[model samples]
Target: MSDDLGFGKLLDDDGLVARLLGKTCKGRNRPLLYGPDLPVVFLTGGPGMGKGRLLRCVRDEFGRHVPAAHLDCAAPVHAERAAQHPSTRSEVTEALRELAVQFGAWSGDGGAIGVPRLYAGLVAVAAGDPLAGQAAGLDEVRRHDDLLPKGSFWGGVLHRAFRSYLAALAALFAAQPLATPLITAILDELFERVSSEGKATLEDCYGAYSGAAGHPRLGLHALSVDFQQGGEGRANAESFLFRALREDVEAAYTSVRGRMARAGRPAVLLDHADNALGRRLLRPVLLDRESGHHDRVVVIATARRADGGRFLYRSTDADAGVVTSWSPGDGGLPVWQRRQGGVPGLVAPARGALLVGMPTLTTEQQNNEVARLQGHGGHSGAAGHGARSGTSGAAGHGQGHPGPAGHQPGEHASRLRVESGIHRLSGGRPRFVTRLGEGAASLRAPDPAAFTDWDLLDAPVRSRAEPEGRPVPVADLLLDDLVTRQLPEELPPEQHDHWLDLLSHLSVAHTGACAQHLMQARQEGRDERLSAYRITELLADSGWPQCPRHFIGDRGLRHLLMRRLYRLRPDGAAWQEDHELLRAHFAARADTGDSGADEPCGTAGAHAAHHHLAAGGVEAAVDHLTGAFPLRDPSRSMARWCEELLAVAGAPCAAPLSGAPDDRHARALGEAPPAGGDWLRRRVDRLLHAVWLYEDRTRPVDQALTGTWRPLLDRLGEEPVPGTEVLTRTAGEWAQLAQERQPLKPCACTRHLG
Candidate 1:
């Protein structure tokens, strides 16, 4: 029910990420200027900034019309080939073959293949052609070679057989060549291997995979790994890969242009060209071919800033590929930031070049996301604070959305915190978020004290925490040998720290207290300030569930405060000092004290009367009943806890009530009706106080209110209380107040006192 924003889910599915990226084309202007068509176009950016996802979008939009191939550079490939060798035609060919088989080509029997068989084959082959010694629990394939043959690796065999079958079927096309033009696609990591090769191979055929012919041809579209490559090794991988992949891509592009008549659009989309690749790799791709520059291919590159050196490469000739940039900020800023700067502009000038930035989600779009998460409001399974990530709040939620009519009363809760944007947090880097999401929520729950004993929380420098607290063998880390095993491995240290810190703070109820305590401890040198800030920053940047305000009551303000705190740390010492300052600031805020009106209408000290009752000590049954009254509010649900404690201690319940019998009679308790007149109001008021208490203290609910129940219930019905609306309805229904003749003012024991 909390409207806090931490629930924004990850852009997990590639399809979703693609959708988000397409929205980035806001201006809808000319095609964005990127690299030349003759050079390989490599998209680069900080990890999770939408490089892969953007490629998927381009593929979705232009793929069918052109023989385009999408390669996920993050997929695992054969181990020996992955690290030991550069991208070979054979490996790429094998990958293309696997994609074809997995996506569904004819079977060797010339019959339609099942999607499952193809998918399984892809997973197996992608598992990196496990050695014969490693083929335990796998179906053994018949092979002529001692080890798996080139085309006989589990994935390779499936692909080769599928290709032949598909080729045979394509013969039926007559006009459209039986051989599918090889469109080799690869993501950034795999492309790094291609860049290392420094050349292209395979021929004939147009599209990305074409290179040398007679053998299987090659044409490739690949991402650049500038961030990952060591500077001394390859200062700008985009340039290197672009030049290398371009040789083949251009040749295939020419073939496609000739065959198709209209010039084929051989496009390259480069994301975040401000990095090293933009400088070294982008010049050739962006240059115009009419003045001896590379021509015929269309290149579209995107960057955060067009003024950066990467996009500033200059040739003497004028109109060298129109240099225009698209900026999203012009239209409107996203809601996440108040008055945020407009999106950067698209930097292409060609009339139909189609350059644009992404579109920001409208307010309605954002609200729809929120509504989907909160469950059309007032419905069951409406995401109670304790509900699991994606489930109904009610027990009968198994019967989810029945038809399009509406959500049934028992429908499970939809996921909360829907986040959508150009580089959606969830879809673009699903693996990263999924890993964090599945593991983090529990770690960041409102209970930091519980985590003190966690083994992962106390991890050593070189050790990885057990994912989700499930024991993962250290040896398993060794198995992650493929380059694609962990894609997008280049988050800025600050952003990484932001996410970590956010998670840590969310783990406690009294986030303000935790912050103050941590800061004070740092000032006292009891805890390392820089280390804690680093941890907090990493979590925040990663979009973990961080309290928006120091207090849960103002989560938004808290988030902003946390951001300010993080930004204040210009240097290590500065950061530590800032922590000290914040410690003092918060201490002062807490000392200001709650200054709300002190009306005690619901309370019956009549002031002095209650004091006298308490003086009588634990045996003052009336005092205990009065103190315990507030616990009945289900909104707080604290009453049940108190009831059990009293029962266990064998406490007396003969509280002073205007109507109930004296302490001497046992059956008199049953004779009185439940407490009335402002009872619900007091309960609600008391409940409000408890929200803050539950957040800051460790007192058991039962023990805290044993002698304060009656007054508390009376307070609960007060206005502005959290559960006021519900309590009002329920209380009236219980009292039948509307039908009562005497405006029923009852005693603490629920009997009419007037």
Candidate 2:
């Protein structure tokens, strides 16, 4: 397996084939074999977590032994056609045709290949036999025509009906690329006529025809064409056509199963099943256990983890039979059987289903991957020796010194440091790891001596760090490819800016962005007429939200996009403006009786206050905090905010503010309270109020304030305000009270009391 990048370990340990074939292993570590019941394996993960790569590996490994077809549902052509057609039946039909074309079942005879022909090809490969040298399987039926009960008068009527239908099929095939709805109607009529006049049913004809020597190929190709042609007929035809198509597929599957069992089970791999058509197909396969078609062919599919429950509306009888299901694991990579239920206690796996959660790389695996990328040949002894020697000279020279763990200097330490950096930056996601590695390789110094600069390996393409240290341009490039470029061209141009604004606001939030919060923000925006519901709908339609809550769902994308938004305005003006908008929106909501307004020590008020302070509105910020503060109660939240404010504004102490009348204080004292009080008296009053509330002997110092409050006390010491001596005495008393209440606990502030 080369073990070059640990791809072998990932596929083998994940149980991809066993679950698809419905095999249950005795233990977690055991290898699984393909079993009798064909399962629909849904392989789901976040974007760029290697779902596609795993599918490719599966195709390459299993294609040799069985007939396996892989279809990428995310292809632009499929999406475009689905958009144009806007019918689930058409989408499924197109998907099937694409699969057939990929598996070489479609002969390009200017006719749509029927389910029977497609099955025959699949079965041929399954049984280790090549198909006979004939393009059309229809010729095999000639030898069995006499087998029909033509002697009886009823049989005679059926025979003629069958012949007429075959002739119609031939004519449709001859025309090539005709409307599927038209052909479906013709087939429907033919079946109805035979059932009424000949006392034969659609199933009866299918059985007799398929049992024939050649199982005469019916040209079902016409059923997938654009029959409605923008007419009212198309609207009504979809439901009927879809039902007929499913029936035909099921019947064909039943016919092919015996052969497939004898030859060995064949499988179909559907990639990017999170797409519209893929989701449509997933519904029946996951929900309808009674459908014989699902039990006939082994189906393997991939989708975004967030969409794992897209098809499952409610738990059903078929909820437990899924052989293997995959979703994003806790560490954000695809693992097996991690997610139990969406709503905790209410849901369970579908009947006959085995759920698998995808896994992220472990630290060791990540390190190995980095080593492989750097061409270290799997961290062997020789490589270690070379690395240490290479970095040794540079270590002493200070170009790349080893920190703390004093190992041999240069290449080894540099490699280790780079590997650690890559793991941290990429979050052990395989796609991100690969991208970062490739980017680093391209940017690596040509000379070996300069290889230890780990910063160069940070992102794939380095952008001039605007304002330095922020990876804005690199983030922009990645987001441009992953999100901006992928956004449907149909989206309004103005919506792009709105999405960016939403992203920017969420980027700085303490909790992840919630759709509900964003809607609230939009409702409080300048345009009161804008519909929050419509904006959310547009975002969903744009394929940006990874889950219902998070827009741009992939964690890597979320991080990079947030970085890009954080640095959108280099001068910080735009950031401050966005934050103010957010603060005002939440404040308006709070004032209007929003549910979260009365939340106990809630983060919303804190966030709003922070933004207000950042925008240089200290009084407004203080008002928000004070208003939200629990009455007659000490609050750690208030204290945290106070500490943050003090750090940013610097110790609010100066000779003029303390009444000593320095030039700056004289100027400040001359101005109006709204303008000058913020920098002088009011600032000191707010800081003192916060300290006084926190130091109220009734309130015990929580862990958050244990070592934290000392910083505020120290900063207060630096200020030569009028009540400095009283504040110092107050701080000493608060420290004494804390030590008496919790003797063993060491408080940093208590040391100042001594």
Candidate 3:
């Protein structure tokens, strides 16, 4: 939000976030437009980027203005009404029921916007075919005459149906374990009652699902069978239900936004849309929207990944699956881009799947929040640390860094230090910054200064730091919330330690193959104990982004795990040994192929170089980058070339180093001795140091590049993207932001590496 959105106010912005973070057009104004627009918006980001919180804010903010409903698709039906029928399908059905009931009650100046047709269908399903058939149906309708909607359609058929409809109907849904089949029957009868015009609308909507859509019974039957039997078809059925819901939305809004041309479109905030149920609900809607059907309702789904999962990026011959991302720093939307092997010319503005990456808390944004949270006008929101923060996953309290109590009552330098420390530590993640802020605030008691209490708050997050007590350590929170607690949810308690071990090892993995190799090596041929798919899925399910290039997506999670690995043994053998395992795998993959995977051998070679560096094989990493691509690329292989170089330079640090390279590191480096093997060895250390400088996001680009990178560039005779981008921009060839001149800083992982 442009305003000082306090901690947890994720959606207070007036389209500033969408404008800045996504490739969404101006149509995505505050309260987002719908109908012939990007009908579905997927809020995708790494975990802790505040997607769920944003969804809640949207629901709360828009419910007052329009017909809006929120449903967390990941959660199963636990409401008392559906407690007996606790299934994901039942959850979907209950949520749909709640939506219909809610919107059905909504009224405008013209009158009510009830989903009479859908209601009739639900009542019909709940009413079922009585043992006395038509006799019980008539009596049943009369019993609830006041409660039912104004309709005689169902009563006429039930004139001879009244034995014991209620008990039998409950049994029908309850006996089946899932209520899909019974619900499908209700849908069939509802469709039968639809007027000819309404049928045409549905026919057009469901036409894609069932290519030729004449028979309502046929369509409902197919959906019933598929929905009853879960999988891809289950998603198809959910998609159909959504279209059915859209028919209601259009019918509801037609009297207002359509005829009156005044009111806004309705919205449905769906959290965890990348999960099993959400994907199902969104699949057909996306397909239909892509095929040129514009529904009325605005569907906003929260996804863990910025692309909203692989369904959007799973390339096929007819369509390349990657969705467009307006990742924060990009100048404009590129013509085509994908993480790996995306077919050229297949991606464009015409594709479906409207996805937006959740923007990180920027240097300015974080500073504003701290100022706003401090409950004072004096926090100075304008005085930020830097522009974009390029953290080196350097999150550890080395020693002597003052905690919350160490500062004096009115000391200005200490205040700046606290703000800078938090910004650096959090790496601009909203959740991390917010939690750290809360913890820091907790230190205000007993004494105005932090004193010894500050160390507890400031200690670098470690695995054993346990998130407990009056004010939990940030490291303990990361360990417990990110790793320990989440383990039991996916795996059994006995396997928690094993998976934690596996996860720690994965902190060093640059790719999924690297992760799989770590899991295999740790398991030692006991295939049952480890499934590459399972472990990788575990990471994704735990809310860590599962990018193939980076096995564990979130930066802080990896740093946490890496520290734990070093401490697993006194000699740091567990940390070093894991790197050895990955080094060997990449070395093998580079020589042969990527175990039937499609990535080129060059990628394997690069990965090999990274692991080699992590295992202290610095010469190998340098040689790989030095020889891999042209030093100055006219073709500009800058993206990939820079990625590998940064990867090598940013290998897991064994020591907890933070901020700029000062005199301490200078003394540690000493001199390269001007010749032979020692020169190359010094270059190895400087190669790493240059990377740290380039990646040190807390400082201005000019300052970060000027330190070690300038010398490293001349020594290696190789240029990287940062060298050019930082220099030209610094040479006054480009417009510079006010925040760009701020001076250098440092930052992560779940846990292990030597």
Candidate 4:
């Protein structure tokens, strides 16, 4: 499955992993800060779009060559820690501890200097003592010790100055329960020492620590206090500590890189950048240029696109020289450049950052995925038998069957159909495809061709490892979970129902609902007092799209919500009512000059027609059909509209136009009332008018007419109704017109007519 899905190609196509390794390769003769000098690459996409899977694949393929450490931000502990506004010291401690363990494995050191040891080593360095407590021989301590010349005059001065700062940090760490105010105070003192009066004490320390290689120097006082007073103070403190730990890790990497030449630079894969902790961690690494860690390690992270610009750019730091630099050019022309330099042509800080977006599988990939699943030994027998039966119902209980060795005759066609259905439903999402494949594998009778549109829409989840009872569709379970997740726990019960109703109404809409449409929907309900702005705000907070054209966040959730709408009212009354309200709302929009070139005529008219027909308003449907029907010329969009209209026509009426009960209509011998007859005649006449317009007005007849109009004409002929003669006459006239327009060529519609 992995090979067929092009997982390997996905990694190699851009050579991202290769480039990252090359950057950190120890033997390279380039300058200290050459070629991107970025340690972080962000993989951004929607949820379940395979970011995690891709990360795992990278680990599997490159783990032996380049040690990779993966940290899942989705874990409960991590998630809870992220939820904290100002992530606590304990939270940061826990995360650092986890990272240290992962890094140890990557370095083949096996937790030799774990988080506790590293923390103690940092304290020792700050205290200017190599052998303080348990810090002796620790790599971090050794790195710090290497920065000073033993017994030198300047080194002695710097050593005495760091003593006070180190003591404060040590005290902060030793505080048993680590109070926030105390930590803040210690950090404030450290910042003041490094950036202000203390700067004179360690004037030469920065140059000595960073080495005189022109790499940006790190300063302890560089920490910003702008975030110290807000609810975000805790998070800021954690960030400071996270940066410190990272520096320690980078220092250790510098020492290890020289010896582990074959392993290349270690890559840290931080998944779930959408989470709070991940976002906080990203700032120092991706946004802070002066940190100098980018020149030492590789950081690969994942985030959702919806997180906006937070991770897209680095903040302008005055100390980092983020202003314009002017120099004399070849012709004595002034050359202006960004202070924080990047790749040759790019000026933005993101040039040093690689952003890879997750993409859906192509058609060929989807086909390969289906074939791989069907060929599996466990599913072969059931799928083969189900294909031969040509009935989906028989395949519903697919479980155990005799295995088949190879594909039988005609199996390819069935597989193709099944692949198409799955592609349409799953949109080639890897996670959804996996779930569908598992469901198919477990089916008692799994016929690819037998799968219908409705079945595809009702996506199944993988059953538990062991059978508990009758299997239920996974979509049903997910729908309930999605609803609960979207509603606020504190919302009143009645308001909750109102929100659900609003969602159901929006589900019926073809495109995303704009604020105005939502406002009208709210007005249609009894809750006119409900503020549209407030409702939208709450929905957005619950993870729904907050853009102008708002939509439910996930496609799978959208499908499940649609199914819920269908089953909301057993008698179909609620379905009709919602559609009626939506139809009226759109019609009013059209009246208010909302219809324009941007609003394609087909989309606007076709959606209204669907709602009108579902509400048993046939006359209104016919009116909408006239607006959408491609009377002048049928393009592909118009053909699709025709298909949709045909589907609506074939569906059973939700309620009689006269509003009579079902039993009343049955007692009336199922005959059409006068109004019903008039409605049907108008619908038929509009369809015929569309045909007439195509025959008389359109030139170089569209080939799509053969597929679009012919099916409707044939369906009409099959109906034993009073308009059979008129349908026959229309078909004859269309054929004659086709012959007159292009006598030499044979028309598909003309052939179908005969």
Candidate 5:
């Protein structure tokens, strides 16, 4: 109805909302809305930042020429209705179903009809008797509609119904003059509503169709809002998507005999990516440029500048161009944040992309927005009337900096209005700036400081450049509040403790091992073992975001064990106890080390050594292993410890084997020493074997063994080494009990029978 239908007004006080509405540098560009070859514009922001409102504006402006599709990714509330009342007609559904059936039947060449075929699986589901009762109220249903009729029990099975839909839409999606690019835009709190499994499947579908570059025929954009634990879950979701894209690209090329063409690249817009889910989801994507997947996809995420590294991962370069930053000097203030890095190298890089930093509202804009809120002659919070009332000055109202009160003589330049540095407070994450600000305001904090505690803010900083500080996980804070009854007021004490134990234990070990520990602890009547069900219930109680069901996949038990094990301190005695328990439990199963536990002990040890060596030298290698396992197998452990000490050792020694000279005779300790003549690895091997050999000596020791033995023992003084005492005693006990001892002797029964 307006002169320029496409341009929409944005929420003035909220930069995040404004950005989502396409109100930045490139906001007004017609190419984004109408083009022969429209470059996909990914609109990203956090929850409640107006992504949906902006999308509606796009649709209103572009009309049929824009031809955009908006997908609500939130799980269907009335699934039955959705199934019966599809968005398109039944003819299209039939066409898709036939296409699916035909495609499945076709040979390789026949299936490549310039368009993908659809599957008919859903029709059968729709027609089945099981849903007959629910369909009774469908008398008013339109027969040919795409959506299922009302009251149909099987209404919203779209995902299951839509494998065929996507295939059928492939050709439509690719057509030019799309006005909308047959756009498939999904807006949802994806991590919260969908099961992890569903997320994974969706990712796989998108990834595969994109053919490594992206869906050549369609434009796909996803906007998701995230909350606390949701960030990690979202990260898992994104990872699945990325991995799917990677695999799909490979498969498409292979299937088409390298004939597959590059489609429009996919992009993701994340609102407020400051919490765990946001961080986990965005980190890898942000770091992807450094990881060599340059051309496949691009991800744009938002975060507050103050939350620091919570939203940043290791960038491929020190700076990836847009908004390049430089360190501040002595005064903690600088002329401008320096731009020191090159642009991120992207594959099929966005043809035209712009990164704009949103600063605080201008004086005039701020005043206008405030005026609108006040209304003409309406009651103000502080006064009954106009500007001259008993209203407080800026200080009293807690607003500050109205151009330094009175400017200096030549400093109209000072009135230029610098950024409020609000970005720094929110890590430049637009959504967070808006939300936290709003939250602060709702609480009527006189200043932002009144709403946010400095102690809490200063707790820890997790930065890529430094590794020492601990991260204050948002999950932890949420859990703490839940425990303290700061929320809901319905959480029981036992429920709170259970949740704490689950999080703590899972944090201590790998997911699989933790699950097993919980199971074992639970089976033995320790309700405190932090069972998955119990943890889930507690999380549900505490309002922590739910993980996708598929994220656990078929590995539910494994996840439980690993999470519980991870909860134990790696350096604590509990760690060893847990590891041994896991090893024993896994060993009892039909297949030990099958699936998650496959690597053999010796092989694992060797791989670790090789990994260390590859990183640098023998000492460095030794240190890594020692750090991983400090107590058990001291010989191996000490060797590793010594190696690290040696690598970082200071002073002036460039010499090899500086102190010791070899005085012992030749000793073939094991059947084969390592090829590189690695003495440390060999020493470890020899010590471990000696312990085993002594334990088994009651049976027999070959001449070959004796030859290896004398030399190794000669290196050791006879009084039983202190560190080896445990091994010696165990071996001694086994030997004393066996009673058929022999010293380097062959069996008499073997030589004379012939």
Candidate 6:
């Protein structure tokens, strides 16, 4: 479990633990700045984002400072134990008992937490049937008798009436066959022995049970009554357990000594909490918290759903809504300094959950991670060996490595390239970084200087871990981990097989409608495919982060899908055919009054041009781009327009064609570049090549690509397009933006890190 849950090597240096703890007000000054509200937090990220591991790290590392207990909702132990029993009522009662015991034992003061109602209900149920429950009733009493106060509650009752144990207990049960009245009487006697305050809180909370509203003693009766007639009634009893558990936590944490030792709110770490059990538990918590029943427990749940579970979160639709997702990007501020950060406000729907993400590795962090994995903890780049853009291990990840000034001549440059390639391929995602790094470590490279791009991106993962496991490529692992394997969980089990094939085809589309167009066409004569909108929802639900413009939102996922479509079959005609489908689809929709002002390639012609280029119809792609070029609103950002146009054409058909496709329109991206004749064609060709250079983020900022814009501006100086002046000015700005996006060279002192 620890091996599976630990990613602290990647996350420890990032201070994610401290940051999350700070959000929960672990060490804040008394009288919290925000109004008395600590929003329930859902720590969310997609697969490979390390949400569960972060929870474990926090629990083990900060156990003393924060009275935190981690519960795996995905595999709730008590729930499973209760599943062996015949009654659903046991689930609510047993779960509350477990929660009470977990929270009860952790108090700083000598205070015990117990659910007397649940205990009394269990005893009463067991006592009613002598054949089934006499032994069970005695077992329950022996197990939790210590949780009940010592003096009168049990002593007076058992000594006075039930001296022979089962005989007297069963005789009492015989007096009342129904569980409700008997359990109520038992608790009423037990309540007299506890502290007046604990009695008051329990009585006040249980007094609201509509089944026996007037008598505070009837709470256990209410639960026992529901337990007798098992079904939805038993399930409804689960909702009341939180109120019971929370009141116990409040009571135990109330002692002056307890507050002094651990003054902050205790935390509950709910891992894999987007599952059915999690939803069931969280829905009631959310409803209770929303209705103003606050407590001293801070819930930090992990969710695979990117936006968190829909029921656990309501994204406050108003501007003043508060959700604290503090990141390293925010200026360093103590938890106390942030104003109204995590406090849920009075906005409509008042944000039910605060959704924060685990940080993906930054360039420097990734470099350090690779260094650590490859048994070179200090090596990021070899300073003085020609790699100048690298920085030292950020946040002090390691004992700094010696500069590779004396190593093999191209050692620094080679390492620099590998690091850049890995970051580009991985997008700094931690799991991918680890896989690629482990893959690199397994390979017997003579020196850091000799590694290749393929070794880092498509590195062997399984052959290292298991003797019989095939050497599945990192990309395929990613495809399986992120998409293919998640389909059953994301969609109906029956749809998983067919939906995967449909998604592969829809990868060529730029938007949902475009995807649907392709999907409907592919499924035109069959009922195999689901509605396209539902498919899009499935992608989002599975946490395939979307960019709205592209149908497959994740860059890495799209890259794998695109390569598959192009390389799966001989000649890769399916790639061109799919692109042609999109080309024709968008072509018909071109010039319609549906283009969004903000969508640079919002015009159908531009999208058609994009697919045209992708499908190898370069001439038509250029024609469409050229035609759409003049239609931009000059007042809008032309620089943004250029950036977006670059994105649309976006290094499509990155590698040149091999065998030919038959369609005339397929010539878009398949041909050799025109031999330096047409200016726009040449410029477009250069722009595409230039965009390719930006893929690797940590690579040297190629100022030389900046020169590509110079020639474009120079060409526009002579042969003007419709928006030439705006284009010329925008060209320089786009050039600068390109520079802004790339990692720049580091100073002499930090030259060995990234």
Alpha carbon deviation, residue 406, candidate 2 (Å): 18
The C-alpha stretches of model 1 lying farther than 4 A from their native spots are: 1-54, 69-241, 255-263, 269-503, 506-585, 588-754
Scored by TM-score, the top model is 6
TM for every model, in the order presented, reads: 0.33, 0.54, 0.61, 0.59, 0.25, 0.72
Clashes of 6: 12
| Cand. 6 Cα-lDDT | 0.55
Candidate 1 positional error at 66, Å: 1.4
lDDT comparison, 1 vs 5, better candidate: 5
- Those runs of model 2 whose alpha carbons end farther than 4 Å from true positions after fitting are 1-10, 18-36, 79-89, 105-264, 291-294, 315-355, 380-418, 442-474, 485-502, 510-555, 566-572, 583-605, 612-754
In candidate 5, how many Å is residue 54 off? 5.6
Tell me how far the alpha carbon of residue 146 in candidate 1 is from the true structure, in angstroms, after superposition: 23
Rank candidates, TM-score, best first: 6, 3, 4, 2, 1, 5
**Candidate 2 lDDT for residue 630:** 29
lDDT of 6 by residue, 1-754 (tens): 1332224432232344444443222333233322245566676777777777777766765544556777777565656776655443354455555555665466433434444544444554433322345335445444554344334342233333322443444456566554543344445445544456545555676776657675656766675566566666655556666665666566545656455544545667887777766666676676666667777677778876655755544455443334455443453422422232344533322255666665667666777776677676565334222222422222112223443555444334445555655665566566767776776665553233233343454566774446588887766676676666555355776676676577777767766667777888778877556777888777666655666556776655666676566665677777878888877776777656545444435556667777787776766765554444444243334444564466555425623233333232112232445554455565565555455444323234445555666566556446533556766776666666554443221222112233
Q: Higher lDDT: candidate 4 or 6?
A: 6
Off by over 4 Å in 3: 1-34, 78-89, 104-113, 124-239, 255-262, 290-293, 321-350, 374-378, 385-410, 442-470, 479-499, 509-517, 525-553, 566-573, 576-666, 669-754
Residues 85-192 of candidate 2 have per-residue lDDT tens digits of 243224554565565544334222111213432332122111111132221322332222332223332233444555665566556556664343333433454444
Tell me how far the alpha carbon of residue 395 in candidate 5 is from the true structure, in angstroms, after superposition.
Answer: 16
Cα deviation in Å at residue 244, candidate 1?
5.2
lDDT of 3: 0.51
The ten-residue window of minimal lDDT in model 1 covers: 449-458
- Candidate 5 lDDT over residue span 559-660, tens digit each: 222333333454333434443444344334414333222322222333333323322233433343433333434444333332222222210110111222
| lDDT tens readout by residue for model 3, 1-754 | 2222332223334342232222122223344333354535677765567777776655555454556677877565624444543232245556677666556555433334445334433343333332323334434323332322334322233322223333444444445443244445445444644556656554544444563366554554555555545666555566566677777667655643446742556667788777656766676666666555676677778777545676554354445444555443443322322233334333322255566666667666666666565553433432453212321211221223444354443333333445555665565667767665555554442211222212324444323343443544565676665566445235655576677677777777765655676777788865358666677776665556544446666655666666567667766788779888877777787688553234422366666776676665656666666565444334325445555565565565443322212431342244432224444345545555555433432221333333444455455433343445443333231123212423222112311100
Who is ahead in TM-score, 2 or 5? 2
Model 1 Cα lDDT, one tens digit per residue, 1-754: 1221221221222222222222212212132223332222233222333444555555554433332344443344532343542322123323333333322322211122122222222222232232222222122221101222223322232324433533432343334422321122111222222221122232121122223133211222211122123343223322333343444334433443334432234334444433333334345344332223354444444433222222342353243244333334343211111111222122221212223333223333333433443334332233332121211122223434452355343322222222111012222222223222322222222222121111111122222444356543211221121111221123444333443333223222133433445544444632323334444443332222333322222222222233233334443233334333433443343256421112121111112222222222222333333444434433333333233222212211112211232322111122232244254433333432222222211111112322233334334545353544444454344234322211122212111101
Off by over 4 Å in 5: 1-65, 78-425, 442-754
Clashes of 1: 118
